[model samples]
Target: MSEHAKLPQDLDPDRPSGARIYDFFLGGSSNFTSDRMLARRVLAVAPDMRRNAVANRACLHRVVRMCLAAGVRQFLDIGCGIPTIGTPHEVAQRLDPSARVVYVDNEPVAVTHGELVLAGNPNAAIVRADLRDTEEVLTADATRRLLDFDRPVAVLMFAVLHHISDRDDPAGTLRSYLAALAPGSFLALTHLTADHAPEAMRAVTELLLDSQHPGTPRSKAYLESLLDGLELLEPGVVPIAEWRPEHGDADLATAAPLGYAAVARKP
Candidate 1:
């Protein structure tokens, strides 16, 4: 058996996991057959799903680069899925060798993969903790070592919040995380939305909810509400394709159906 196959009981392959599914969407090999099946279903509704994923990931890279340019050296990436090419640490460390990053995720396999990716990398670490349990993660040993809340830090939530059902109080959950950060800290968030293609999106959303990690699309109004106290950065609250897109508008116009992406700074 492969090393990942010999993984412990907590990394259950029977039920679909958000991390594995996302990895499949990225065309990574660190996923089970179940994850690929779900990815196919998701693609059926949004044919350009892979493009959408790439676009969102590009947004993440840009945001990280911008934050680093602003002198932010610490990073807290919540809901961080399975590590892939050009992870936040990889990008940030290149900019500032002293940069520190703490990755938080609720999935055991994701945490394992993240750790494996960061192995022997003294500047980064991953903490396997529930995203909703803000207090635990904030107080966890990993956080203590990798992040210093006294100074400015960048908190990234990419394509992960959608997994949090409204019933889970995602806004409240975000507030707690924001509350932990110091002033001048940055908040980078990108969420899945059905506002563009509601009919097809509804079917895909239902399939996800019924499978394992369920989610609901946040309307523009709802997404704006999440930015209540934070100071939104330039070109505020635009489509994922419009957020500092490297490619021209024509490419983005036909790329894929995606969510809204925003980056804000706490004053």
Candidate 2:
């Protein structure tokens, strides 16, 4: 709603975008004042927004490495925000040179920046599309060009599903993406939740609800329900900070708003 900032020609600086806000939180320079202001407001509500963002980002890296370690090199990253440090392509390709990734986002700024960062990387590309439109996302020219449907793919939807409203049928969206993957494919997700967080997070959630990135925090049970048909990995769905935390949570805010993280495999 804060629209008093400068944006790129293809972007509306006045309108706050989730990707830009996320970029701001990630310590990146791809966001505008409107995004920073909104991010700061959420920070006021949940003082640990930075820690929560770090935990969510850590989950993304872990999931990518986890899938790659399992020999799944191709990734279909839906709702991929603005490219930042340690992005999927960066992590995946560093571990395995042949790792292929198809990043998808609805924001023009994110897609534009993502393409710029990924330019000349034959194994990675970005597609601008809504995550809710599974058919279009799965069948896009870029997606088909960079990935093979018959092989196992790691479909990543990190910290984005909460932005999808009930009317969007988030559960069906998960199913649609899963149905498009091969038998050995995987679904990894990390979504915001108020289940184990402080009451202040509810205010933050409501604030975001009124913004361009309207999000609804689901319960732990509901978060797991999205992966009902798939086989969940060990540790199940837990707080993002606790999901295979490679480094000790020395500085992690234990009281940060919980963001549920989990990965399931298709049978």
Candidate 3:
């Protein structure tokens, strides 16, 4: 058996992986039973987030399409999960065949799966690197080769930044990327927040601390602070479902928004 096959199947097939759990939530088959167990517990508290996951993905697609429409064709998807569907490349390339994408994820499984999925797509590539290490990720061979630093690129991080702990200075790490982007580049992100969620969501956050990864849900104000250097776009920092919802999507104004989503330009 392969080394990967020999491992036990937990949240990540061996441990709880945010990417794997996200994949499971997105209706992908790449997750393990442990991931489902945790997901069930979390979902039970805030049922909106399950729908939020779907919305978050759609939000990502819209963000990519928006960037494409704005004449920005290069992309950098940080903390990109195991590409199950509606990926940055998939969304961007579908609209403009010349679109280029560089997906970065610290998870091995996510990178491996991304590579396999993009095997024949010359305009796209994946890098196994931490998002916090902006220099390493942006300077990697694939990134240097596929993306042009001089052009306006869209950096996307959907439903992933909450996984970064405050101690690691998630805000500070973000500044590095913002500084690296060329003029008029964009930064789009969605982050989980306990402020507007059910009280029980806090317990779920604690539960994650004991898992293989540590994540802390921030407040709307805190999440907004992360955008200090960027200029907010229209309908700034609203709930995931409320961010330019596609036609036919249910009205999210009355629903309990599980996380916040927004896009900004580095002017």
Task: Say which candidate scores most in lDDT.
Answer: 2
What are the candidates' C-alpha RMSDs? 1.9, 2.4, 2.7
Regions of candidate 3 where Cα sits further than 4 Å from its true position: 1-12, 251-254
Measured against the true structure, the TM-scores of the candidates, in listed sequence, are: 0.94, 0.94, 0.93
Candidate 1 residue-wise lDDT, 1-267, digit = tens: 144566856776767777887787787887777777888888897776677777777888989999999999999999888899989999999888899999999887788888889999888999988889999989989799888899998999998899888789999999999998999999999988777878777877877874668878788788889999889998888788788777553365443366889999999
Lowest-lDDT window of 10 residues in candidate 2? Answer: 1-10
Q: Which of candidates 2 and 3 reaches a greater TM-score?
A: 2
Record all residue pairs in model 1 with backbone atoms less than 3 Å apart, i.e. clashing: none
Error of 2 at 222 (Å): 0.3
For residues 1-267, write the lDDT of model 2, one tens digit per residue: 134434446777767788888888888888777788889998888877778888788888888999988999999988999888899999999998899999999898888888889999999999999989888998899999999999999999998999999999999888888888899999999888888775866888777764578878888899777888889998899888878778654356466556888899999
What's the C-alpha lDDT at position 64 in model 1?
Answer: 94
Please state the error at residue 6 of candidate 3 in Å.
8.0
Better of 1 and 2 by lDDT: 2
Cα miss at 165, model 1 (Å)?
1.2
Clash count of each predicted structure: 0, 1, 0
